[model samples]
Target: MTHRLPVRVYYEDTDMGGIVYYANYLKYIERSRSTLVGELGLDQKKMKDEDAIVFVVVRVEADYLRPARLDDELEIVTTHHAASPMRWVFDQDVMRGDELLFRAKVTAVCMTTEGKPVRLPAELRAKLT
Candidate 1:
């Protein structure tokens, strides 16, 4: 399944050239992932508090395909791609209408507050798959 969320480019998200900053694409995907997980019934805050587990991004591979300008209406689409016992990988994309602006493969690992890796909860994995 794919989860999508709309984002409008603000002045702050643009560079001096008025194009969306390179780094902001990461932020957009982050928000999209959060919403996707939440929609799957995984409450991050609750997981941290109750399960003592937190998800941390360990890797990201992205490509900038096209440029998005200020006030552009963009959509972020996120989908679960793969997972192991302790890590998950998601594929995400940012688009403006039919044009693909950016895409990324994000990998996150479950860890304890103390920083030790932990196994991902079965429920969360099931939901993602």
Candidate 2:
């Protein structure tokens, strides 16, 4: 199943053309990822300070199809492409109603506080099921 997050485009998220600023799409995607982790009872700050591990984006590939305007109510769809002990790959799409504005294949690696890749924690990995 895909995780869906509701996003409302604000004026600050827009460009001079009044459409969403290009870079803000990345913000939307990251927010959904953070929410997904939170929903699974994983807190990045607590995990990092306590367990000494965190998740970091290792790769990002995106496609921009259409423009999302200010005040548009959109849905960010995130689906797990691969959820493993070492890393998680998510296929995410940003949409306004039935219209797709952008899509991305984002890869995040489980890492140590010092920035080396690490294995995913057992309980956290189970949530991908």
Candidate 3:
């Protein structure tokens, strides 16, 4: 399944050339990840209070395709690619209408507040159903 969220390129998200900044693509991916977790009924506060765990991006590999200009309405698409006992992997893409602006593969690991890797909590694992 695919998850999508809409985003508008704002002035603050651009570089001097009025094109969306390279690093801002990662921000959009992050937002989509947040939405994905929220839709799964998992959030930071609940994770902290119940499982004492949090998911953090351990790695990301991205490719810049076309450029997006300020004021362009974009959609961020994310797919849950794989999951293991302790980690999740996703394929994400940023698109301006039908044009691909950027794409990435992100690996996130479940970890405790102290940064120790942990098994995916039962609640999160259950939600994958």
Find the candidate with the highest lDDT and give its number. 1
Model 2 spans with C-alpha error above 4 angstroms = 81-83
Candidate 3 or 2, higher lDDT: 2
lDDT of all the models against the reference? Answer: 0.90, 0.90, 0.89
The residue pairs in collision within model 1 are none
In angstroms, what RMSD does candidate 2 have relative to the true structure? 1.1
TM-score of each candidate? 0.94, 0.95, 0.93
Evaluated against the true structure, the overall lDDT of model 2 is 0.90
lDDT for 66 in candidate 1 is 96
Q: Encode model 2's per-residue lDDT on 24-106: one tens digit a residue.
A: 99999999989988887888899899989888898999999999999999999999844667888999999999999999999
* Candidate 3: Cα lDDT at 75: 99
Query: On a 0 to 100 scale, what is the lDDT of residue 117 in model 3?
Result: 98
Per-residue CA lDDT of model 3 for 1-129, tens digit only, reads 589999999999999999999899999999999999898777778888787888889999999999999999999999984478888888999988888889999999888988899987677777664
Show the lowest summed lDDT stretch of 10 residues, model 2: 120-129
Superposed model 1: Cα runs more than 4 Å off: none
Clashes of each: 0, 0, 0
